[model samples]
Target: MISTRDLTGLPDVSSLRRLLQSLAMLDAILSPDWQYRYYSFNCHWAFGEEWGSMRNGSGDEFYALFNQHGCFLKGFAHEALMTPCRDNPPKLWPGLFSNVPPEFSECLNEPAFDIASTTFCIWRYHDGREWQLDDLKFPAGSDPDGSGDLLSILDGTPETYYVWAEEYYQEAWNDTSGLTRDAVAAVYRHQPLSNELVSAINSNLRLEDLADDLRDIGYPNQKKPA
Candidate 1:
């Protein structure tokens, strides 16, 4: 598992943005219901920012912010020791956001991202020299800060998401959805969306069904895809 602290293993800001868009678009197609979807992206989130997120619907979630300065990703594994729920004042772990640069200071209090629930965070500047984490020690335990699984999907592997989607959304829908692994990979590659690809994943959905998601995620719409 790639933890947020394992910055070298994570993709750079641009790649990570594309990957997050793919994840959001895939979830939008596979999950017709907006509320139940595991991932989401909003291109028009702010004047100069885009937001990406994952919510398992059982309290675990991760959110990312992208803009001119760079990218910031924060995750909250609700069951971890660092969870805000464990404290009387609903406190965040010490030093979690201490090193955030001025470029991303706004993200620290972004209400839409649920800043208070954070357990772990990683960030990088637009120059992309390195992905940085805080200089704090975490509680002793395996994956205590919840960074392990939360940031692992950003490895930019389509198969990683495919295997996970199969198990995570399995049979929860009409049954034929989410079986098209190649199509999923195509989206991960930032290929233009197409009718065939949409139906392959979920026979019930058409290209038009994903129109809003494409717009929201800022994904390339496929008038024609080779």
Candidate 2:
């Protein structure tokens, strides 16, 4: 469902690289317990060990990866069900898109709704163009159901992968909690934060709060309660 044409007209690859770097750093600051995994040309970061498992017992696992070629992927999966659903499935947390620029929003593909599975997004940039696929599926195993591209890109052993449930945020707070604007600016470099990202981080890093923040930014919050 995704094609290289989608990667047209995006900012240079350097910008995307910086955005991902900043996001990884911020995620580290917000969730200190997470482990960082690195490969030769790519890296993976996650909040829990059973991130890609169909039998994850943790609350929910969040995972993200970035490739040297400017491909960014991130997603979350709910604790697996004893019996998989047969109909309308759970949507993924859109908080990953919180900091994404508005211009890039137009590049997102329509979501492919399905039953219980890992929900994710993939963005690729090359030759000053960009392409995005959102709400894609990630089933257990190395087969290329839909996430084949993602799997192929991260072809390396992880340096460190922890198996545990980690809190994303310490507690609710009014300010950045000592995170200076200068620090954020340094990671972002030329990339600017979307209003959605600012609100999502401000709401104490709760997934629900991030969902609300997405709604406030005018994007459809499929994870939000009706």
Cα RMSD of predicted structure 2: 17.1
Residue pairs clashing, model 1: none
Q: lDDT, candidate 2, residue 111?
A: 39
lDDT digits (tens) for residues 58-90 of candidate 2: 433323333333444443334232112223563
Best by lDDT: 1
Model 1 CA lDDT for position 54: 89
The TM-score obtained by model 1 is 0.94
Count of backbone collisions in candidate 1: 0
Q: What global local distance difference test value does model 2 have?
A: 0.34
After superposition, the stretches of candidate 1 with alpha carbons farther than 4 Å from their true spots are 224-226
Model 2: residues with Cα > 4 Å off, grouped in runs = 1-13, 35-116, 134-177, 190-226
lDDT of each: 0.84, 0.34
Worst 10 residues of 1 by lDDT: 171-180
Candidate 2: which pairs clash?
7-129, 7-130, 7-131
Residue 7 lDDT, candidate 2, scale 0-100? 32
Q: Per-residue lDDT tens digits of candidate 1, residues 86-131? A: 8897998889898898888889888877888889888898787888
